[model samples]
Target: MKNQLEITLQNRKNLHAILEQTPNEDLLKIPQGFRNNIWWNIAHVVVTQQILVYKLSGLQMRVPEALVDKFKKGTVPDGTATDAEMKMVADFLLSTITWTKEDYEAGLFKNFNEYTTSAKVTLRNVQDAADFNLFHEGIHLGSIFAIRKML
Candidate 1:
């Protein structure tokens, strides 16, 4: 599991580089045929991790309610993210994972509300949610790469 987290963290750093160097205009632009922009995808990665790990674990989430509403599954780009918003997203991209690792190691995740994900996998424990989160992030990372190409 630690290996998985390390691999995912490394992938996020690479994704962060791509996003950091991308022009703001390109990050916000939804090229033709794309359903969302790079900013939304990045934010979604952060938001989804919170929901899967924190919310499902019956713990208070680190991200705000509005952010979760905006980026939860089944939602699309609401609008272009400003520079400040993008920076915030960039921060959470790494911070949240670090916090989760700390929280897991500290045994903060003692309960899970028991939710089955859209992929039909039931997460009965916090570790399951954490494992599932890696798969979820990988999908969104691919989306980010595809969206970046369109910009």
Candidate 2:
């Protein structure tokens, strides 16, 4: 789980780099044939990790309820992200992972509500969610990369 968190942290650093470097307009652009934008993908991953690992573990999410509502599964980009909101997402990309690692090390997660993901994978514990989150982030990273090409 420590290794998984390390990889998640490194991946978030890469995501943060992209977020910092991309023009805000580019981040919000939804390319043809895509339902969402780069910014949405980045934010979605952050929201997802919280839900999968924390919310389902019966703990409150690190991020706000509004953020979770906006980016959680089945929600499309709302077509707007204020500068403050963007920065919040960018900041959480690292901070949330750091928190997750710390919380895990502290043994805060003792039980996880079983969840069957859209991909049909069942997460029975925090460890499963931790592992599944990596795959979820990889998928979004690929989407971000492809969107960058189109931009």
Name the best candidate (by lDDT): 2
The regions of model 2 sitting more than 4 angstroms off are none
Give Cα-based local distance difference scores for all models: 0.82, 0.97
Tell me the tens digit of each residue's lDDT in model 1 across 98-149: 8888888888888889999899999888778878888888887888888877
Model 1 residue 4 lDDT score:
62
C-alpha RMSD between model 2 and the true structure: 0.6
Clashes of 1: 0
Q: Give the TM-score of candidate 1.
A: 0.91
**What TM-score against the true fold does each predicted structure earn?**
0.91, 0.99
Each prediction's RMSD to truth:
1.5, 0.6
Question: Residues 7-42, candidate 2, lDDT per residue (tens digit)?
Answer: 999999999999999999999999999999999999
